[model samples]
Target: MEKRDSMDAFGAVSLIGFAALIAFNQVVIAVVNEGLQPVFFAGLRSAGAILLIWLWMRFRRIPVMITRETIMPGLAIGAVFALEFVFLFMALDLTTVSRTSVIFYTMPVWLAIAAHFFVPGDRITPVKALGLALALAGTAWAILQRPDSGEVSLAGDLFALGGAICWAAIAFIAKATTLRNVTPHTQLLWQVGVSAPILLLAAPLFGDLVRDLQPIHLWGLAFQIVVVVSAGFLFWLWLLSIYPASGVASFSFLSPVFGVLFGWALLGEEVGPVIFGALALVALGLVLINRPARAQVPQKVA
Candidate 1:
């Protein structure tokens, strides 16, 4: 395979891995959420991820360097990371995984818009505009499909949307600021370390205190720590370091696709034609928005 194709393949696999991890985590969380508090669950997962990654880094003899400049950006990113998961876990509690994933994967749309304003070379092209419109339309459609049982939580959907916006903001900040200079492992470490304590403190306010934990809760925590946070994020960061950012980003749409499939398979959630159709639009939009533009050639004089 060509280099780009190989990179694309890696990106695809990384995305699939992320999708699988998320689907599995959702199921585990759904079970564990019944026993433990969401914030506590999030904190424990972060703690586990931190421990695992720290061990791996120690085994590999990787240095943990913290500079004054890196500290602020790392903390900033960590704060956002904490908020993102808090909102996400709350969303999962309030809404279905399928709905939450569809709304959350709208990160690319927000990223494109944020890039248009922030990044130097990224402008709002017509194709990107179209992509954003399609994504927005799909999100609206999903929201409208909520049942009339008066239990549908707009707050949860908005929280998911906020999480997506924060995700885009973090990506832009990482790109524009000096934060990118820090190693991905260090960045991740700072995020989890700083966020874990904060989540622990906020657990009570969010009604996420671990009053009664069970064996399955421990199993769920293990999966979140080992698979979802540690391995999945490590692979993601590795891909970002090696592959084109746009190429890697293009695969995120697959998360929702897999979310729906796994939600159906595991949670017995219903998947209608509208969900599939919305997923198609989201996938197409991601492709259009992230695909590289054709290079212009100079005309040759005979």
Candidate 2:
């Protein structure tokens, strides 16, 4: 089977898998929040992911050439990573999964929009434009639906939006800066390694670090470190390295769809007609965006 530069079968499958893992992650965070304050948990997760990735890198003998050139931009990316999770974890704590997911997963659209201006080959195509439009519509529709129980937090919604922007900013940095040449492992290290300390220092300001800390919570943190951060984020950046930014960005639209389903199944949250319809739009958009266009060949006149 041939692998194309846009989105190949493996790329599509990998992206969908990543989206599902991230969707399921929201539920895990909600559960873990029972034992840990959001910021502290996020900080600890980053710390854990750093250690995990470092071990993997060491075992594999992956040389992360951290020269003077990569240091400043690397720290900047890590700072962006810190801000992204700070807002995201807080959003998860303050809002329902459905609401936060709908709001937060808009990062792809934010990223595509920025990449259009900054990235050379990542300019929005007609299909991607359509996808972005539908994505925004679906996300907005999902956000508008009132939850059955817990009152929605405006602050949480805003935090989610901020997190989306921060997420976009990271993609922009990767595409538009020298960091593009850096290995995905090193890029991820910049994020988790730098974020660990920044987040840890800020964690205490948010209040108590631990709630009713339990064994399952420890397990949850471990899952986040191993699967979501270490494995999932690394996979995402790797996808970006091999595929077009717009195509990869478009696939992330599935996350909120999975998020809503998980929220319904795991948290017993309501999934109504509006959400179902929105999920369809998002899924449809993903198909459209990922469908590779064929070359138009000119015919000679006889």
Candidate 3:
């Protein structure tokens, strides 16, 4: 659980960097989907991230020691991490990046709702409530505006929702379990290390592992493992350990905004007027939800 630490400038920068990284990730996932099956690609990245993280730690002389106290929680988070990506990758394959991002980035709403009951100091204030309404409305708008000419899928939307919930589950578990006390790398180790084998095993179940295999796909997988899975997640965990999670989480709204624009510019995906309007609402809500208050935002501790 986080303490009542509010967001500072450095925290804001970190959130922005993370948001951009993940926003770009949507484009990468879409590109990679051409050569690798969604689930299979996810599984490969999970496993590859394990090696990358280990190599990184080794180079940094950071010892990754797992004590008995951490095993169970680590394993639990690992499983959740695996499931989260499975749904996410599948959703990306089944739908456009704009649509998938619109739905998937609703994570803050779900997290706030769970925090209201499970986390102390997380009660939604009037402003926050309004923010939630706006954000949720934006998500609903995105789901509804399946542009007849654009690619959209119900199954994909559901899977994206599932992925968002699982994302919240990871946050909740981190707050509630011993993970809160561990180092960021240790926490990430639990996720990628545990998730690797499980995902690799499940890959075959999703059918053929390879598509029109290409060098670019391999490079994309490397980016997912080294940049996103290893470095990005570790940084997020560290942020969670130091800053108020609510503030950190509020930044997630930027991902969809960035994702949609990137999708259009990079992938040539259509962005309808409805999506632009939805982005406005979601952005407004995030600004309010993350607005600095008089008191430090109390992060929930299990």
Candidate 4:
């Protein structure tokens, strides 16, 4: 297959994997909600992912070493990872999953802005500016449409947005730093391993971890570890290596679209008109953001 075709295939696979991830994640979060405190559940999930990835790397003979210079940066990235998920779970706890997912997936918008400053040759063009406008408008539309019955909290929405910002920052750092030299597996390993203990430390502030866990909770933890975090992320990182980063990142917009659909199907969550409108805007923004800039052609001599 041509490289373009191969990249297209990778992009499609990434979208499918991400859609499955969104659905599975929502189910697990719902299950966790039944008993486990979100933070404790998050901690367990991270630990499980760490162990699973460690075992997988060992089996595959993938080296997991880090240079001394990379160590502090790796730890910093892991700290951001921990905070990102902490705010995400808190958002999940405080708001509807669909709302949180939609708001959180706005990472691309933040990423575009951050890239203007950090990523060389990735400065925001006019098209990207338009895309950012549309995204912000859609986000405002979603917020304004929130029901007066108190189903959505502005604080929770802000926290979810904060998670997105953290994610964008982490992506920027990963791309800008020498950390890119590390393999994706090692990057993820550092993230989960370091974040696990940080989460455990915060777990106590939230609730009693042992008392909250149930059998279903354990099942949720297992799914998150085996499927979502371990296998799913590995596949995503591999896809990124094979495909154009912009193409792969563009597919991330599909997650919220799928999240809304799965939220309606499984959670019986209502899909209001406002959400549909927001979806349209997000779709348009994604197109604008991902559209390749037209190449300039020199005018033919008369």
User: How far in Å is the alpha carbon of 40 misplaced in model 1?
Assistant: 1.5
Which candidate number has the best lDDT?
3
For each candidate, what is the lDDT? 0.78, 0.82, 0.84, 0.80
Q: Model 3 over residues 152-261: C-alpha lDDT tens digits?
A: 78778888889999998888887877787777787788888888888888899988889998999989988998889888988787787788756886787789889998
Q: Which has the higher TM-score value, candidate number 3 or candidate number 4? A: 4
List where candidate 2 sits over 4 angstroms from the true fold: 1-13, 238-250, 282-302
- Candidate 2, position 59, lDDT: 94
Candidate 4 C-alpha error for residue 192, in Å: 0.4
Q: What C-alpha root-mean-square deviation, in Å, does candidate 2 show against the real structure?
A: 2.9
Q: What's the ranking of the predictions by lDDT, best on top?
A: 3, 2, 4, 1
By TM-score, the candidates rank as 4, 1, 3, 2
After superposition, the stretches of candidate 3 with alpha carbons farther than 4 Å from their true spots are 1-14, 239-247, 296-302
lDDT of 4 at 67: 97
Better of 1 and 2 by lDDT: 2
Off by over 4 Å in 4: 1-6, 210-212, 298-302
Tens digit of per-residue lDDT, candidate 2, span 91-170: 88877777777778777678778878877866788987997788778766766654555646677778888998998899
**Model 2, position 209: C-alpha lDDT score:** 94
- Runs in model 1 lying further than 4 Å from the true structure: 1-11, 149-151
- For every model shown, what is its TM-score relative to the native structure? 0.91, 0.87, 0.89, 0.92
